[model samples]
Target: MAGRQGGHHIACTGLSAFPLTPMRDDAVDERAFAAQVARVAASGVDSIGALGSTGVYPYLSRAERARVARVTVEHADGVPVIVGVGSLRTSHVLEHVDDAVEAGAAAVLLPAMSYHPLTDDDVIGLVETVAAHSPAPVIVYDNPGTTHITFTQELYARVARVPGVVSIKIPGVPTEPAAAREHVATIRGAVSEDVTIGVSGDPFATAGLAAGCDAWYSVIAGTVPEVAVRLARPALAGNAAEADAENARLAPLWQLFTEMGGSIRVIAAIAELLGIAEQPCLPLPIRGLDGEQRRRVAAVLETLDHAAEPDRDE
Candidate 1:
């Protein structure tokens, strides 16, 4: 769990916002991206993860991804930044790790990217190699949805043995809330206590935290850090009532995300709706919501904003 260069150890707990990388003219829009990062940093998130799936890391070129990481660190304004360094090739992942370390990232989120199904040994090797080379601590990102490589409790235990592998981001268990809780417990039991277990996929966050997850690697936090924090604080403190109440309020937003494919597309539309950025997303096959879709998102945002405002005593 020690950081490189005597830096602070990566604290993989609380809300870590995975902000979108704004794009313009088919390239990263530096100005817009900075603004978004600054906004999230100021919103009281525990950390910022740049170039994640939500950040369209796979879509951007290595140079662009590196630039985004540096920019994220700069705009994080003292908040820890965890840069995603997942790539198809282990060597390419190392290059990303170097970039993140050079940019002073607090940690690197490493996902085993593979076209062919990866064996448990393949995942272990990938993580060991990346952690060996990375100056920053490596967070094994177990996102089966995108990477198609799921990390079992046994695999997590093996990866935790790798030096500098400090945390794991478990993809949220979408169904059977009890199963999600059990899944978190299983991972928690299997891995060393030092290897923090965080949950991704915002809808499952409340249950995940209730189930003993250490942190929430959230897409919703990227757009609405205040809301995410409100929900997380209560949940993490074992206040299930308050946490569930807050989560219930966000059900509509989560429903929208599910209806519109997924968080990547919906979140990009959300950023645009909030004026945090203009059409921040990857190009076609992964485009943002259209005008009509945006209006629906705007409506939900307005409702959420109103509900979040403190009531005035007459």
Candidate 2:
């Protein structure tokens, strides 16, 4: 790991997760947002991902994203803030990367979002375009759950070899253990094991860590970070059993947000319930959670808090 490439290693080592901050009439409640980041940072989270899928990235204007990134970085002090730069076009996303870097983000996380499915060559080209233009190191996000396509191990290896590409964020596709381990072993054997492979989904983070993934990029990390920090840090350090126990405790909240119909929308609503944001406003076409879903989600959150406390004692 010691070479010219080794200098960028720090960008990939941390727990990268975003906080969902609900908006009130197209405006962010900065006070609430800052407090949320501060609380998460104080709980020992490695990095804060602002203006991400959890943070309602699609709803914010470019200017709003910049301001939120700046404020989040300010509140986090020395903690790294990885700003999302996912957009419809390369130029627009590149500009967002510029704004993120200017706002003092340590790195920029980007999704592969070109029209239609992308080939390995296309994925490599897209990663190169962003890495070449970004002011900071680029972390490629492979989220086939939301996005239409995911980069293959061949493409991931190629991009990992790129000059400015330091990290890759892969969502854990399997919700079960045997399959999850297979997914990790396959990817680790395919890519340079030295390149940091981060798991994004909550259900898969523990399994991903147990299977030797370097870090986690989680949305659940945003709302109830104490649980994420307490559990994930140990998992990354190679304690799979303890990690799984913690995951079991928090599984209800994870299932509520992700397993339900409107995962993203439900998350926004929960952010409001937790008092982290004023309103649960998503981008156009992504509506708020229904009343019944909100009640169920709230009930699960209570269980998460109760379950998390005992695990911390362990």
Candidate 3:
């Protein structure tokens, strides 16, 4: 797996936080979104991902998405901002990339979006074309859960060879600590050593880092960045025992994410509970957490926040 190497590395290793796109009355809440970005940056996350899956990229119009990207970069406060540029069409994806670049984003994340299942060659062509067109570095997002297209190790190796492709964000968590380690090692061996491998699905972050993945592309961090930093710091520092302990503390929140269907609902509820934004998601049929669900989520968030607080005596 070899190709020309000219992609600019955006220093996105470690805990890369994905911030949710706060909405107000079916419109992108620019002020709330900027506050969210600032909050994550203040929490010491390595990078900020705007318009990620949790950001509801597909649900928003191009102009709205571009505005989010611009606000994210502006509020990131020198922290690198990675903009998601995934669209069903290659041409549209390229347009998004240009918008991200023009908006001063540091990097771009591209997922293979398809209404029909894509072949290996089709996926490869998509990445190559995007990488060739993107002025900034491209992070290949392999989220089979949403896109229904998985990037195997072989495909990753091929995509890694594309010029300007600097990283890959893989989804799902490994079954165990050992499996997580093995998974990272296998992917690292398959691609160029210079290529960073980041794992999404926040619950798997500790294990992914313990296994040696370079970064954690987190959903939970979109709202609760402090918890994410606590988990990431230990894992990145090679403190497996501490990382595992942190992960244990996060178990309740992770459970809520699983029970609530996904992070979007739970995070929207958390954002509202924290008074950061109002409860608004992608329109009907894809609503935010209901009243009962909000109460339950608020309870969990309260408990977690209390547990994370430092002792007053100290």
Candidate 4:
């Protein structure tokens, strides 16, 4: 997996996180999305996550997801774009892997599949299946909070050995320093340090850096890519002071997302406030923010210097 076959060493090193693009009226706002990607890339993020949970992969039709993926890669310049290929059906996920390759993504990220409370073998099979089909590389995304299937240390080690399996996206849960250490050990033991370990959690990204994770995958990056980039740079460079200050500024926003439900709502709120798209077009049940919640999110966005425009009627 480490060869130089027209692919660079997968740079999962800095602020690389999944970003949700707010959709509108059964179509993604192409103009707005291009602008959003350009802004995120300019903010110093190391990677862009397309069709992730935030991107509402489950909600979009196959073609729509492909369009988003293609547009994302085109606008990302050289930044690595991790294509989300998490689908319940193995065939569908493989199809997405092909799409990622065609769209020129650097890697694929997939959540642990169907087997709720998946066994080691179950996790291994899923990882192996996706790894076999992915053109670039694949990262096993382990988020028990959403997928309801948890891959233990032994299971992770087994999957890590799969061909083309190059990274692990672990939730920075139980966010204590000790917990982060245990996770890093678990992931590192499963694969060589060559296989990156990406921590995902608002506080966990910062905590994981302290715990020695190679990279971080976070939702916080969607709202404030600059803050996320600043936070990651200091830690990656071994500068604790700057990292801590950056995290301090991000803490309130983290609190806001958690208190206001979680990543989905926070992403929707931010997209609305930024006016990047008309409405947060989450599939049924994941609707736009209510009046009070909108006010709260607006307050948070007001603190940032990023450009904001009035909502347009379409």
lDDT of 1 at 101: 86
- Clashes counted in candidate 2 amount to 0
lDDT of each: 0.82, 0.73, 0.82, 0.74
Clashing pairs in 1: none
Error of 1 at 250 (Å): 0.5
In candidate 2, residue 169 scores what lDDT? 87
Any runs in candidate 4 off by more than 4 Å, and if so which? 1-9, 115-117, 305-314
For model 2 the local lDDT of residue 264 reads: 73
lDDT of 1 by residue, 255-290 (tens): 997898778777787776666666545555666777
lDDT of 2 by residue, 1-314 (tens): 11222112245775776887656666876777787788777777778888777777766788888889888888886778888888877788888988887888777888876567777786777778888877687777887766667677787778788767667788774767788788888877777655678888777778887776777887877767877787887788887778778888877766775667535766676676666665555555666776888788878777755212211111
Report the lDDT tens digits of candidate 4 across residue range 245-269: 7777767677886787777887777
User: Which pairs in model 4 have colliding backbones?
Assistant: none
TM-score for each predicted model, relative to the true structure: 0.92, 0.88, 0.93, 0.91
The number of clashing residue pairs in each candidate reads 0, 0, 0, 0
Name the better of 2 and 4 by TM-score.
Answer: 4
